[model samples]
Target: MADGAGRRVDPDVDLRVPRDRREVAAHPAAVLGAIAAGGVLGALARAGLQAAFPHGPATFAWATFGVNVSGCLLIGVLMAVLRAAGGGPPLARPFLGVGVLGGFTTFSTYAVDVHAALVAGAPATALAYLAATVVGALFAVWAGDTLTGRLLSRGAR
Candidate 1:
C-alpha cells in the first residue's frame, strides 16, 4: 500500500510503527483495550487541560470546544480508515468514539458553555456553538463516510 508520501509498503503485513498508528492494524482485542486505556487518559487529560487554564469563569470553554472539534477530526480520520477496511469494531469504534473522543470532549462542558452564553445574553454565541458542533460533527462523519467509501471500493476492485 502507499503511504502519505506515496511510498510503497508491503501489503501482506501491517508495518505501521507509531503506537497510535499501530491501531490501524492492531488486533481487535488490543484495539479495544487501547481505547479503554485511552479513555482514562483522555478523561484525565481533559480535566488537566480544564484546570490548568482557569483564567476565565464562564466565558472561556475554548478547551472544550477545541477538544470536541479536534476529537471530531481525529475520529473522522480513524473511522474512515477502519471502516474502509471493513474492520470489526469489537473495540475499535467503541474505543475511539465512545471511550477516547467521548471522554476527551465532554458534552457536559458544551452544555455549560451554552448555558453561560445565554446567561450572559449572548444567545448568538451559544446558538452558534450548538449549530457548529452539530453541523461540524455531522460533516466530519459524512466526510469520513465519503472517503472510506471511496477507499473501500477501490480496494474491492
Candidate 2:
C-alpha cells in the first residue's frame, strides 16, 4: 500500500497496532499484570496521602494537588530515565508512566474539588486552584525531565 506521501506501506501491517512483534506480544498478560501492580501501589500511596492530609470544601485540596503534581514530575523523570537508558524495558513505560502515575493522579478528585469550592461560594479559590494545578503540573513535568536529563548527561561525562 502507498501512503499519501507515496511511501510504501506493508499491506499486512495494521496501522493502528504496533509494528513490532515484541510490543504486540508484550501487550497481553505480562503488561497487564505490570500495570495492575503499579496501579495498586500508586493508588495506595495517593490514598494514604489523602487520608493523612484531609481537606474540605472551600479549602485547597492540597493532598490531591500535591499527588497530581508530584506524579507528573515523576512521569517526566521516568521518561527521561527511560530515554537515557534507551527506553529500558518494554513494560517500564506502561507500568511506571501509564499505570503508576496514571493511577496516582486523581483528575476526578481535582474536578470534585473545583466543584466543591464553587458550591461553597468560593469561586475565586476554585479558579485559583484550577489555574494553579495546571501551571504547577506543566512546570513540574518540564523541570523534572530537564533536570533528570542534565544530571544523567553529567554522570555520563
Candidate 3:
C-alpha cells in the first residue's frame, strides 16, 4: 500500500482491523496521545464556535460548515508545507494535521445536520448544505494548497 505522498506502506498496515500486536504497534503511544489531546482541543474549539453561532435543524449550520471547510484548507496547507520542508518535525503531521485538524473537522456532525434538515422537512436546505459543504471544502483545499505552494516557491527564489 501507499500513503498520500505515494510512499510504500506495509500491505498489512492497510487492514482496517489489526490482527495482532505487530499490526497494533504501527500506532505508537506518543502519536496516539497527541491525537487524543489534540482532539480534545479541536473539539472544544468546535463547540465554542457552535455555541457562538447557534443554528437549528432547518437553518444553515454556519459554524460546522466553517469548521469543516477551514479544516480542509488547513489540511492542504499543512500537507504542502510538510512536503516542502521534507516532512518537517516528526510529530507535526500527527499532532497538527491528523490530530488537531482531524478533530476540528466533523463529518459526523455534518451528516447529522443534513439528516436533521431532511427530517425537519427541509429537503431543499439539506440538499443545498450537502452540495455547498462538498464544493466549498474542495475549493478551499485546492486554494490553500495551490496558494501556499506558490507562496513557498516564491519565498525560495
Candidate 4:
C-alpha cells in the first residue's frame, strides 16, 4: 500500500468483492423485496445495539456479524428441527437462509466493514476479523449440522 508520502500501492492487494457481485447484487424489485426483509431485520438489530454496546466506531457493525453467524447457526438447527417435527413446512429454505440471511449478512457489508478497517489502517484487526468470521462461520455450520443431525437422529430413535 502507498504511504503518506504517496508511494504506489500494490494493485494485487486482495479486496473482498462478492463472488458474483454484479449479478447477485443487481436483482429486480420483487426479488430484492424477499432479500430486503432479512436485511431489514439485520439492520434493525444492528441499530438497536447502540444502546447496549455504546462503544467503538464499529460496535454497531458487530451486530451484523453476530446476526450472520447466528442466522447460519439457527438455520442449521431449524432445518433439523423441522425435519424431525415433520409439521409439514413453512417458508422455503432458500427464501429464509439464502434469500434472507444471504441478503441480510451481505458480503458487501462485510467487505465494506473490512475496507473501513483497512483504510482506517487497522489492517491487523480487519484481517483477523475477516479470517475469524469466514473460518468461524464455516466451522460453526459444520458443528451446527452435526448437532442437529444428532438431535434429529435422537428423535428418530
Q: Pick the candidate with the highest lDDT.
A: 2
What TM-score do all the candidates reach, one by one? 0.61, 0.83, 0.84, 0.60
| Candidate 1 residue 105 C-alpha distance from true site, Å | 2.2
Candidate 2 lDDT at 147 equals 99
- Ranking of models by TM-score: 3, 2, 1, 4
Per-residue accuracy of model 1 over 1-157 as CA lDDT, tens digit each? 2232112132112335233346546575776676678789779888887777653433546667667777767666665566454444445655766577767877887887788888888777778877888787667756865776687778889
Residue-wise lDDT of candidate 2 within 27-74, one digit each (tens)? Answer: 678767877888898999999999999988998989999999999899
Clashes by residue pair, model 4:
none
Structure candidate 3, residue pairs in collision? none
Error of 1 at 62 (Å): 2.4
TM-score-better candidate, 2 vs 4: 2
Candidate 1 ranges beyond 4 A from true positions: 1-35, 48-60, 151-157
CA lDDT of every candidate = 0.64, 0.78, 0.78, 0.54
Clashes of 3: 0
Q: Write the per-residue lDDT of candidate 4 for residues 1-157, one digit (tens) a residue.
A: 1211112121111123222233234554544564567656655665565345443533335665675677667656655554454411223332454455554455676787777777777777788778878886777666776799797787679
lDDT pick, better of 1 and 2: 2
lDDT of 4 at 152: 75
